[model samples]
Target: MASTDNALKTASVLAFERKLDPSDGLFHAGNWDGRDDTTAWKPVTLREKSVRGTISNRLKTKDQDPAKLDAAIENPNLQTVDVATLPADADTLRVGFTLRILGGTGRPSACNNAAYQTKLLSTVQGYVDANGFGELGRRYAHNLANARFLWRNRIGAEQVEVRIQHLEKGQPKTSWTFDALQLSLRDFQTPNGVEKDINSLADVITTGLAGKGHVLLQVTAFARIGAGQEVYPSQELILDKATSKKSKTLYDVQGIAGIHSQKLGNALRTIDTWHSEADTLGPIAVEPYGSVTTLGKACRKPTDKLDFYNLLDGWLLKDKAPPPDQQHFVMAILVRGGVFGEAGKD
Candidate 1:
């Protein structure tokens, strides 16, 4: 490596905003047949339920004695929790959100080092020219069409349908409907019949990333489970668990049960099959460290030179182009976006 190149350092004020912006998913309940007419659907509301409960949790040795166990069982563990359920007449759960795919991906939101930023942007442009955004765009579109953003709500659904509309102003310009259950979460293979539609959707996303045009999409997913069945919404992270009155707090937007945009984004970007453990673990979300918080382990690590910093620096600073997969990983980190500046030295 050249001395000049070795001397170059990462920007101390580097940051990037997420290119794929999504709004919070608002939940609604309606009959499966009424999916075409969502105007009549009702917003899923939270209901408070109290349960007598039982003492099933692990107890200390002292509390395991026969008399003590009997006494504890008598008291039991009573609690009040918030739950969301589809109305008895409504057999479908509708999740709606708008996604805006912004351009200027490679450009940093903040970068102090002009020289380094220039090289980085140039490298990203080179990638765009050679590969285009087709691969990543296709995967993202697939996630949408598959209704992966529905998360737990899609599980055991009798039928899942996804409708995506290209919005111009307040109206839809073009629309696509998908039988979400036909798509697989494990791979990005074009499902036999939906190939053309997936490709069309992928092209729009690619165009958005390439700065060809602005892309705004309205997405609606219908999951037909059963009437009066429990529907899963995003849970609020209670910082003070002990002091909190309700054990389970469902997320709400003005009294209407909803899912977090972060959770939806996480589901959509679960396209990191480039990591080493992907074959076994399936596709985790595209994160800088390839982190899957639910799994409690990072798929990529700096020690292994598989992390974003290592691969990115190798490409831009070291003048060593990474493999296509690794390149995709680096670009994905940019799409995910973060404040990635190197910390200042003392």
Candidate 2:
């Protein structure tokens, strides 16, 4: 029975806390053979360098004349940028970080309407009771095993290996190693050779999400890109365009080049094949609006009623549930967590 005060009314204040948390990945350099003993690896550091770049962008109509273009190329653009590369003696890059899988999915951090909140939790519980988080867990585990979080660093590597360690009280309970290149980034398919390891890792993550206290994991990935190859680190977004002299600023933590936790989270949640364009566009990071910033357009629009808010409201208020895939998408948004309260108008 719906409460009289809250029946058919959306909560004005609702929010869920993110469940999967990861620390910033720190970069280190070492010989590929020395990967077994990462204790001897050296911290990768950032250096500021100046490079002369030719003006190659399309010129304005007035400046397109041959004489004008030739003169422009002579005065090359000098760019001061930050760069990180493996030391001459090191042929591999080591990135390491810790991940914490939290519980209490679908439980809002804040909600004023108890009735609405109760229904939401019930809905989430129903999904867990039925699905067991296997699909979601498998995709996340796939991302980790494939080293997708390495982004550009994983590209063009001669070889890549990823190691995941389940931690208990600062000690490893179990560990798994992956030959990352064999795993495809375009899909979450666990190859026959590595299915056992992938499933084991997924089981741990799904268990944590099922409210089994919490789970901690230590992750390390090695990319053998050859000695002195330039490594890519997360670039800091500069808001003050005029004040900064450098066009690019690489992220660092206390002088150690690193990747942001947000970036890692994005990579982990790239499991949304349920979107409308799954036929063409492939997976994107789970989002309420199905937004891919790089594409500059939304895939799950309200017009289609496939977005988070529409599906959630219909499911909760109208007794209308979305399709199975959409139901999974809704649950993923709840797992990602955000302020989803409806706004009031005067």
Number of the top candidate by TM-score? 1
Please list the C-alpha lDDT of all candidates, in the order they appear.
0.92, 0.91
**What are the models' TM-scores?**
0.95, 0.94
List residue ranges in candidate 1 displaced over 4 A: 1-6, 59-74
Which RMSD values do the candidates have, in order? 2.0, 2.5
lDDT value, candidate 1, whole model = 0.92
Note the residue pairs that clash in candidate 2.
none
Worst 10 residues of 2 by lDDT: 1-10
lDDT of 2 by residue, 1-346 (tens): 3567546677999999998899999999998898888587999999999999988777675747888777977788889999999999999999999999988888999999998888887888888888878888888899999999999999999999999999999999989999999998887777889999999999999988888856999999999999999999999999997999998999999999999999999998999999989878888999999999999989989999888999999899988878888888888888788899999899
lDDT at position 307, candidate 2:
89
TM for candidate 2 is 0.94
lDDT of 1 by residue, 263-282 (tens): 99999899999999988998
